[model samples]
Every structure is written in C-alpha cells, then in structure tokens.
Target chain A: MTIYYSEDHEWISVDGNVGTVGITNYAQNALGDIVFVEVPEVGDDFAKGDEVAVVESVKAASEIYSPVGGKITETNGELEDNAALVNSSPDGDGWFFKINISDSGELEGLMDADGYKTFIAGLE
Target chain B: MGAVNNDLLKTPLYSLHEELDGKMVPFAGYLMPVQYPLGVMGEHNHTREKAGLFDVSHMGQVVIKGNNADKWLETLVPGNIIDLKPNRIRYSMFTSEDGGILDDLMITKRENDIFMVVNAACKEQDIAHMRSNLPDHLELAELNNRALVALQGPMAAEVLARFASGADEMDFMSYAEVEICGATCLISRSGYTGEDGHEISIPAQKAIEVCKALLSEQEVEAIGLGARDSLRLEAGLCLYGHDITEDTTPVESALIWSIGKRRREEGGFPGAQIILEQISNGTITRKRVGIIPSGRVPAREGTEILDSADNVIGVITSGGFGPTFGGPVAMGYVDIKNSENGTDVFLKVRKNKLEAKVSATPFVPQRYYRKQK
Candidate 1:
C-alpha cells in the first residue's frame, strides 16, 4: 500500500482500486482533542477536493476534503462513539472511510509520504 | 503556518511554555499557548478533576488610588464600589454613556487603593476610558510589571496552601498578600472557572519561579486557553467580545445582580437612567439564557435561535461541548418572552434545525471556596 497526502493534511492509503482515507498524524496533533467526527454516508460520490467529512475538536470544527474523486464504499462507524480514536491512532483504526478510486491519475497530484514530511516541516 | 511572528509580545513564562511543548498561537497581540501536548479536552478534564495552572498574565492589572477613588469609580460602573469592604472583590463592568457595556472587570477593594483586572483585549481602551473620565486627583497606575496566574480545581486550595500561608482560610472573592516561593504575591480566591481556585498576581521577574513551584505539586498541571474557554463557557460566564459586547446591556445580559441595590435606586453611574428604567419597567427586549442542545452536535457562536414557529428569536454567543457536563451546552440572548427557563428553542446549525431548550446555568454546580461558619 502506498500513502499519499494532500496539502490540507488529509491522507489516503491506496491498495488496488480501493483507498482508505483519514487525517494525517500531523493533522490530528494540530487539531488537539477530537470530540466528534461526521462521516459521509456509504455510496456517497465525491470529486477531488470536495468536502466529504467533518472533524470537530474542542477548539473548532475542520472540514475534510476528498483527496481524489471516488464513491465511498465504507465508513468507520466506531468514530460515532469513540472520536478520540482519531487522536489515538489516526493512521490506523481512526480511518474515516474507504473509497473506490475513480481515477488513478488523480493520486499523482498528491505528495508522497517523504514529500508530505518535508511539506509539514516547512509549515513549522 | 510558519513559526509565530517574533513581533508578538511574550509573557515571562514564554520559555516554560515552549519547554512544555505548548501550541503557541497569536492572541491579543501576544504569542501564547492555546493547548499543550495533552490537548484541550485532556487539560480541561484534568482541571475539573484535579488542579490546573493557567498563565493569565495577559490580562491587565491596574491600581486606582487617591481620596474619593471609590466614589469616582462608582460613577463609571453600575456596581457599588464605595461600599465594597477591604480585601473583597466584586464583579463589575464599565458602562458606556448610552447604557452599553464597555468592559466587564473584577475590582478588589485593597487596603489603601482599588485593584482592577480587565480583559486583555480591552485593557488599553479601558485605561484610556478611565483616565479621560477620572479627575486629576484620582490616580490610575497600570501594573505592567506583574504576571497573573490561576490555580483552579477541587484540589486547588490544597495545592496552593502548600506554598502560601493563610490561603486555605480565605473565603470566596477575598484576596490577601502572601509570600509564595519567596515572592510576595497577591492571591485571590477567585477565578473565571466555576471551580474553587486562586488567582495569584506575582512579580513579573518571579512569575516563572512561582509557576514552576506550583507546577511541582502533583495535582497542578498547566492548562491552556482552549480549556480555559471551555471551562468558562461551562460555567456560563460571559466572554467579553462574544457574550457581552458594547451592543449588550447588563440587564439584557443577565448581569443585573452585579448592580448594587443603592446604585439601582439612585441614579449616579453612566446609563443609570436607562438601566433603572429597564429594571423597574421590565421592558428588556432580549435576555440572555442558557441552552442545552439536544444532540452531540455542538452549536457554535453565531448560530441562530428560532422559536416553535421557526421564527428567528436570538443568536448564540457562546456554545460548545462541556467536558464536565458531558454534553453540548450554550448561552445566548433570546427574546425576553422566550428567555424563560425550559423554553423550547431551535438552533439553526448549518442547514439543519437542531432541537434545544433554554436552561438555567452554570451547567455544573459552582464549587467556590466559601469559609464554613
């Protein structure tokens, strides 16, 4: 699986045609404590950069944009009762949804893991 | 997005905050920490359960002295400053000439002078307002060389008593000068958080030492502005610019109790005519009320309030998830007719209409340290 990141701090891990999407660890840390997560419904369609989800922290609410155009196949239901999972394991169990990639070419526009690290460093 | 601008002022505790990995943000022209590694929720819960140390040096501290100081102050605010006994603190606000709130502040009657703590954002303007209004005989001395810190929670008294003698014996709203960690500090048994706490005003040079000594106590952990905001909201307190502004009147803001009975009867302070008229006639158009949203969706500031008929009635001033209350709570102004307790209201959050009710506050019971007789 190859991980791609957006400048907006969202991350997606791709395997075959399906991609698992979640906020990056850096993003979760910046957001502080997660209080609520609003996930998109299964079978919802989205284009790249469309606001597909919301993550509310103790401070403020942030929108999560779709990294690539796709149809949502599944959502992490555990976040309904346990939003802290996003802060605890943002890259793993805290995944927001699974999307069926509409176009593989869209992933090329995103930064790779190393490139994302350098980008985040520049932010500091 | 890059490092905080160097031009922003830093409090004496700036190095300590960086050492603790505090998330620095620019607020009110100061580079201050909004949260720590534990995050806002964790820091908030820690303060509720144990004790939280807050760096509140950004707030303005001033001393008003000279003969007839209290009498002169009484003309500016609606509260009874002249009758306030020595060493006692009273919550009051500076009222505009037209019956609007200029700024809310805490005034303490010290031995020979009055000490005031004003909001950080309004300090400069407040000083100018007071200076321009007061006679030359009355002196206003801004204490720029002091730093304020708050130790708050159920364990606050116990933790504070370790260093400052006589702290455990102080009652709510009372203050005393004491030696803490070898620095002479003015400690007050009052805080914005509803929890039992003490706000210590220490010398700017000794602020870091005093804070370090307090943090050494196991019960005390450094909290940030994030938890401070949530804690005050849960306590149903008014934030300066949001909950109470120049556009809001004290009567409409539900702060009528802060006005002294004598001040309420005789007209002396600014806006006395209008405030007293509203008091006797009960003709306040809008009134502040607490609200509890029905679901986990937190209603934020600027959310519109609607009545049963779906007509707009009010707008939320402050709203968020209360860590201590374990739910979403808010406070806002509604039409006087719909401001009664238990009045059903709807909040327009985004595109959906959420169910809510006007409820009484402080959502959690206030735990002030009143000396038991």
Candidate 2:
C-alpha cells in the first residue's frame, strides 16, 4: 500500500499490475482548490508523460501527466461532481483513476514517499 | 519579514498574517497572504456559505482632502465624485486622455477627507497620478499604515454585527466608522464579491487582533488571493491586470455605467472625448462572455476564442475553473455581434476545439444585502 510520486506531483499506489493514480497532496496544496478533474475515460491508453487528467483550481488549470504507460481501467466519478475531494484526500479516496500498468518497470522512474518528501523539500 | 522590502512596499498586515501561519506570496511587489491554515478551498467555500476574512492590507489607502477635493478628483477622472454623499462609496475608473482605463478603484466620502482605495499593484502609480494632477490646495496623504480587511459572503453581516452593532442594518454601498476589535475603523457594506459583506479599514497594529477577533466566530476563516479571484470572477467584477488595463477603456470593457451621468454630461475629465464618443456610437469590439468547456479540458489565458468557422474572434483575457460554478469561465473582447448573451462559441485549447457558450455575467446570482427600508 505504498505510494509513488511523479516529478509532476501525481501519485500512484501500486498493487501487482494495478496503479491507483491521483495528484499528490503537494499538488493539491499548490493548486489551491480543486474545481475540476478531467479524467480520461476507462480503457483509454496513454504513454508516460501523456496528458491523462486536467486538474483545475480557482486561479489556474494544469494538466496531470500519466507517470507511466497504462490503460485507464476506472475513472473516479466522484471527482466529476466533487473535485474538492482531491484537496481533502489526495492520497486515499481522492484517487483519480486506476490504470493497469503496461510496464511495472516504469515505476522505477517515479519516487517513493521518502523520495517525494525530499523532492518537495528540495523544491523549497 | 519586516515591513520594508528592498523597494519598501509593505502590506499593513504583513507580519500579522505571518504570525497566523499565513502563506505569504510575492504579489505585485508586496508580500501578502495568499491563504491560511484552513486552505484556499475551505476559505472560499466558507465565504460562500458563511464568511471569509481577507487581509487586503496591500491596497493603497489615501486621503484626499481640501475644499476642492471633489473638483480636483473630477478633473482627473470623469466620475461624479461631487455627488458622493458622506458614508457612500462609488466604483470609478481612472481614465487616460484618450479614455483608456488607468485602473479601477473605490472612492468613499468619509466624514472628513475622501477615502480612496486603489489596487495594490497599481497603488504607487495611482498615487503619483493623483498627486501630479490634483491642485495644490487638495492635499493627498498616503494612509499606508492601515490594514484593509474584507469580510465577505452571505453571513458576513452576521459576523460583523457582533462587533459593530447595527452593521447588518447598513445598506449596500454604505459606510460608517465603528469601534471593534479594540480599534476604530471604517466599515463599508460593499465588496468585490456580489454578496453582502463589509470591508473594514483598521489600524495596522490591530489588524491581526481584528482578524483573530473575527476568527473567534465559528463562521469566519481567512481567505487568500486565490478565493478572492474566484469570488470576484463569479461576481463578474474586473481584475485590474486581467480584465481591465490602461489600454482598455470603460466602454470597451462593458463598464460604461460606472461613468456617472454627471461625468458623462460634464465632459471635463480625462479621456472624456473618446469615452463619450464610444458611449454614443458603441465600441466596435466588445468584451464578451465565455463559459467552461463542456469537455474535460481547461481553456487558459491567451487561449484563442474562435467562431463557428474556426476564425479567431478574440483572445481570453481571464479564464479559469470556478470552484463555485463547478466549471471554467472566461471574459474577453470579441466582435460586438458575438457579445450577446447566448452566442455559441468554441475555445481553441491546444489543437482541440472545446465547446463554450457566451453567457451573462454574475454567473451566480448576486446576493448583496441592501436595507429593506
């Protein structure tokens, strides 16, 4: 149940071949309020760095990149109506989409919690 | 951080905000609070449902006094300042010789001097403009040491009434000096958010105490510049940098009514000729409306707005997802024909044509509280 983070501030929790994806808490903090989450439809496939989700705040809108190659297995319908759930629980219930990882090897490119903490610290 | 930076611009409540765990951001050359511990969304929703306390201490507060106060200000801007009775506020724009917007500001006629509050980023320039143009007898004093806090939302009056008795009784666009949080201040029943609210101008040192005092109420939380943008946007209120600028005129920006009838007829202020002409003939271009993309994409600033045939009609001046509206909205100058309320439009997001509709402003209905009597 460990979380991995992309440099772009998206996070994924891996279990076997599945990765539960959402923006990091840091991303939510930076984004102010979550007004919209433009999630890809289930079965949509994207390569790493492809625009998978669009997260918006009151002031700005930003693209959420897929940290790894994957086929979207499920999209968080809750975000469609209550995007602020991402601001409240970015790590758990606020997860954006579930993707079946085409290559777990891509996880190597992402960072773990400690690494993500260090990365956020380095940002300061 | 201390009050003075290298350039010495300071928000009156700078240190107070820091003490309250506010995240200070460098905005328009001044260090100001963008949010507090409850966060931007919480703050924004709180203001909508209850009340939000904003440290608008960065805005420039000036006192223009003398027998010719109205006369001098009138010459510089084509607004009816002379008609502003004491305890009333007016939304006016500073105009250039050609009738372009200098900046938008609030002018309140107090018991004594005329209290003027201009945008934080444009404060220095506005003060300079006033000083250069105002007659010598009409003195300008920069009240730089005061804090301006806006208590906005539906419950704003209820929260302020606890401290300032009869605050709820005040009508829209009215002001009165009251004592609260152990400080004397000017309280105005006005706000950028199209809601019932109050903007309190308190002494610098008492800013934090007043904020804390307001926070003592369960309904009040500190909102940052983030929610401030959304609330104002939902109200269709113009932001100086995004919606209005020196190159944009009042008529073109769809704010001709702000030019008081007296000013329009007097025709003595700066840029009166062009403004009056534009008012009569109508500006060829108009600032149109834009709603959120029905698709899962955001149309940001500088995104091109296109007509049905894919011809570029205008550029987005301000576009963002409104938390309250549950979608994105934007404003921009389009051809006059496309400025109608129900115009069909598309926003070009990257390579995709995202569907958008030209909608009326105040996307949310204004809930301002005016006295029944």
Candidate 3:
C-alpha cells in the first residue's frame, strides 16, 4: 500500500485501484474533539478537491475535500455513531471512505510521508 | 475607534496558558486559549464531573461608587438594582432607547460601591455610555489591574474552600471580599456553566500565583474558552455577541425573567415604554428557544430555520455539540408562533434539511447551590 497526503490534511492509502481516505493526525488534533462527521455516500462520484465530508467539533465545522477524482466504494459506517474515532485514530479505523480510483496519475500531485512531514513543519 | 494595529492583546495568564499547552486563538481582540491538551470534549466532561479553572480576565470589570449609585445605575438597565442588597449580584442588561439590548452585565452591590462586569467586546462602548451619562457625583473606575478567573463544576466549592475559608457557605449570586494566597480578592458565588462555582477577581500581579494554587488541586483542570463556550451553551446561557446583540431586545431573547416586577411595572429604564408594552401585550415577534437537532449533524450559527412547509421561520444564533448532552444542541430566534416546546422545526445546513425540535433551555440541568433555609 502506498500512502499520500493532501495539503488539506487528508490521507489516502492506495492499494490496487482502491484508496482509503481519512484525515491526518495533525488535522484531527487541530480540529479537537470530533462530535459529528458527515461521511460521503457509497457509489457517489466526486472530482478532485470536491468537498466529500464534514467534521464538526465542539467549536466549529471543517470540510474534508477529495484529493483525487473517484467513485466512493464504501464508507466507514462506524463513524455515524462514534465520530470521536476520527480523533482517536485518524489514519486507521477512522478512515472516512474507500474510493475506486478513476485515474492513477492524480497520485503524483499528493505528498509522500516525508514531504507531508516537511509541509506540516512549515505550517508550525 | 478601531484598532489600527494587528497585534492581539494578551491576558495576565497568557504565559501560563502557553506553558499548559493551550491552543492559543484570537478572541475578542485578545490571545486566548481555545483548548488545552485535554481537548474541548475532555475539558468539558472534566469540568462537569470535577472542577475546571478558567482565565476570564478579558472580561471588563469596573467599580461604580457614589451616593445613590444603585439608583443611578438602575436608570440604564431594566433590573431592580436599587433593591439589591450589599454583596448581592443581579444579572442585568443595558437597553437602547428602542427596546434593543445594548449589552448584558453582572452588577454586584458591595458595601460602599457597585462592581460591574461587562462583556469584553462591549466594554469600551459600555464605559463610554456610562461616562457620558454620569450624574457627576457617580464615579466609574474601570479595573485594569484585576484578572478574573472562574472555578466551575461540581467540585469547585470544595476545591476553593481549601484556600478561602467559608467560601462554600456563600449563596449563589452573592459576592464577598476574601483573602486567598495573601491577596485580597473579590469572589462571586456564581458562574456561567450552570454549576456550583465561584468567579474570583484577583490582582493581575497575583493572577499566576492564584491560578497555580487552584490548579494544584487534584480535581481541578485548566479549561479553555472552547469548553467554556460549550459549557455555557449547554447551560442555556447566552453569548453576548451571538445570542443577544444590540439589535435583539430583552423581551425577544427570553430574558424577561431577569427583569424585576417593579421595573416591568414602573417603566423607568431606557426603552421602558416599548419593553413594558411588549411585556403586557405579548407583542414580541420572535422568541429565543432551545433547538435540538434529531440527527448527529450540528446546525451551526447562521443556519436557517424552516417550518414544515419549508418556509424560513428563523435563524440559529448559537449552535454546537453539547458534550454533556451527548448530542447536537442549539439556540435560535424562531417566529413566536413556532416557539412552543416540542414544536418540530427544520435546520437548513448545507443542502440538507435536518429535523429539529424547539425545546426549553439548559440541555443539562443546572446545579446551583442554594443555602438551606
């Protein structure tokens, strides 16, 4: 599996033609407590940079954008009842959705592990 | 006058907040901690179960002293300030000439003077309003050297009692001067969290020392503004800017309970005519009511409220997730006819119309301490 990160703090772990999407640790930390999460529907088609989900904290609501164009194959239904999973495990069980990649070339635009670390460092 | 510079002001506990890993954010032109390492949810739950300390120095505290100070101040608000006994506090508001609220404040009658705490954003204008209308004999002194902190939650009184003797005996809405950590402090047995707690005002120089002492207790944790906002919202308290603004009248905001019967009958304060008529004739067009969204989605501020037929009935003023309530909670101004409790409403968030209900406030029950008769 290859992992890529977006500037908006979303992480996609690609395996074959499917990629699992979720927010990064830094993004979840910045968002604080996760009270509500509106995940995308299965079979929904989205283009790159489309607002796919929304994460509401106690203080504010933040949008989650799609990093690459794809059709959502599955969504983490557990998030409907336990949104705090995004805060506890942003990169693992907290995965928001699984999308079938429409074009493999879009991965070139995202950052790798080292590059994302450097990008977050610049933010601080 | 607008602040030309971009620099944000810091409270006396700025350094302490940073030391505690508080996420600093800009609020009311001041750098304040939005949340600490525990996060807003943790901090909120901790505050409800135990004690939480907060740095509220950004609020404006002032002293008004003179003969007939209470009567003089009563002219600005709709509360019965003249009847307020020494050390008793009354929640009041400054109303405009047209029956709109200018600012909400806490007025405490001390032995020789009246101590008032106003919202930080409205302090300058509130002070200016009081100064221009002063009777010459009355003096308003803004306290810049004081830092206010609130110790709130179920265990707050027990934690504070270790420092200030007899603090637990003070009745809710009572104020007193007490010595804690070698500093003379003004303590109020009241809080915004709907919990039994105290709001302490200490010298700015002694703020750090006093806060450190309060935090040293096992049950106490340093809470931030984020949790404070949620806590107050859960408690059904109104935020000055969002819930009650200069354009919102006290009658429309469901704060008529704070007005005394004498003030309602005599009609002496600003906007008294309009306000009194609204009280007698039930002429308010909009009413503030608690909204509970049925779904997990939160209907944030500015979200539109719709009736069953999709007609826009009102707008949400304050909306967020209430950790204590374990669900989405909100307060908004709805058409008076649709403001009944259990009336079904709809919240327009993004493209979705979530189901919501108009309900009574304080999603969580308030636990105020009242002295046994």
Each prediction's RMSD over C-alphas, in Å, is 1.5, 3.1, 1.8
Q: How are the candidates ranked when ordered by lDDT, highest leading?
A: 3, 1, 2
Task: Say which prediction, candidate 1 or candidate 2, comes out ahead on lDDT.
Answer: 1
lDDT of 2 by residue, B261-322 (tens): 87777789888889898888875476646455665455777888889999988778877766
Give lDDT tens digits, candidate 2, residues A1-124.
Answer: 6678999999998888999999888888887777777788899899999999887776677889999898999999998778889988998779999999999889998998899999999887
Q: Highest DockQ: which candidate?
A: 3
lDDT of 1 by residue, A22-108 (tens): 999999988888888889999999999999998888888888999999999999999998898999999999999999999999999
Q: Per-residue alpha-carbon lDDT of model 1 for B236-286, expressed as tens digits?
A: 899999999898889999999999899998869888888888899997999
TM-score of chain B of 2: 0.95
Give the top-scoring candidate (TM-score): 3
Best-to-worst TM-score order: 3, 1, 2
Q: Look at candidate 3 and tell me the lDDT of residue A75.
A: 96
Residue B197 of model 2 has an lDDT of: 93
